[model samples]
Target: MAQECRIPHTVLCPARTPTCQTSPYLEAIRRQLAVRTRRLNDTGALTPGPPTASGQSDDPDTHDGPARPVVQLLLCRYLAEHAVEHLRCVAQTRHRHRCPHPIRALTGPAGTWRLLPTGPRRGQLALPDVLMAIYDLGHLPYRGQLRWRAQRCPQHDAAPGAADLALAEWQPFDPLLHAAHIRTRLPHPEARRPGSR
Candidate 1:
């Protein structure tokens, strides 16, 4: 009779710990950690790459090219946290000042997003939740075309003059920016300084 190879169950075996043995929740957590690690390893992953010699530009206005996957993810996450009311026209006027126009308006009793029409477009275009999911609007059809129009005010969208627009800038997304809103209760009143009030 062959000798029985007895091993303590408490000891974790290298081969025994296969991914298949892990719980679905643990597996999901592992996958998320792996993704985060990969992103961290990639330098400047959240930001767009430098303009390439092959005509690839970082300026969204000039370059119709697809945005990087990381950038798209960051943008989607940021936009999700910050409402449309916070967004402003990125376009610059002839005088070199930022355009003083809201990108889109929350109109009506329901407060739906209505695109400020470019011209005699009488009907208000309501932005569907499905449409908001799109990161790069350039790929979509006419609806996407209309969506992109919101990036600028009606004046700039209708007549984009020859102006050296600013290059699109990207910064690392900070979840803590909206920490107070996510919390269950407001910060204790005692936390505030006496003179600040």
Candidate 2:
């Protein structure tokens, strides 16, 4: 019998999901694009079009099937929504639990991942500016597992110390390090002050 997954959060988070297998169509496109990119590099040519697709599509949105990035974005949105629906709110504890506001995807520059206002009111600010997952683990040359971080849930801003004190308890995932943890680890004035006693 399969072991019951006691912690659904670990298996369900976008970071824990299995790496996507490349589809044959996309692989073919990738190879074609690679060759074209190399050819263009050799000839030093510049044009305004999808640099990644060789006539496969003038626009990635009109392709035969949704591209990998598009699919990944949809998956991220689904997971974010699911987390807000099923998982406990970041502010929840054994004694106190507060329902979380819905999670919303924000758009910004390339590789931007932000969770902002959850309500459905598209305006100049509500639209997504980028396409990426909320989390990304980078492999730096010397750094073991450190990487850039994404925006936190806006609700955390209300509590005076919630941002700092509630970090370790924010999410169930072990590898998902919060910004507060980083700040806490750095030297603080209180720690360096000389004892007056």
Taking the tens digit of each residue's C-alpha lDDT, what string does model 2 give over 39-76? 54333252224435465534332221112111113122
The collision pairs in model 2 are: 107-128, 107-129, 108-129, 108-130
What is residue 179's positional error in candidate 1, in angstroms?
12
Q: What is the C-alpha RMSD of each candidate to the true structure, in Å?
A: 17.6, 23.5
Q: After superposition, how far is residue 8 of candidate 1 from its true place, in Å?
A: 55
TM-scores, all candidates, are 0.27, 0.20
Could you give candidate 1's per-residue lDDT for residues 103-194 as a string of tens digits?
Answer: 44333111112111112112534322221112233333453244333355445666666342543333332333322222111112332223
Error of 2 at 2 (Å): 66
Residue 126, model 2: Cα distance from true site in angstroms: 38
lDDT of 2 at 88: 27
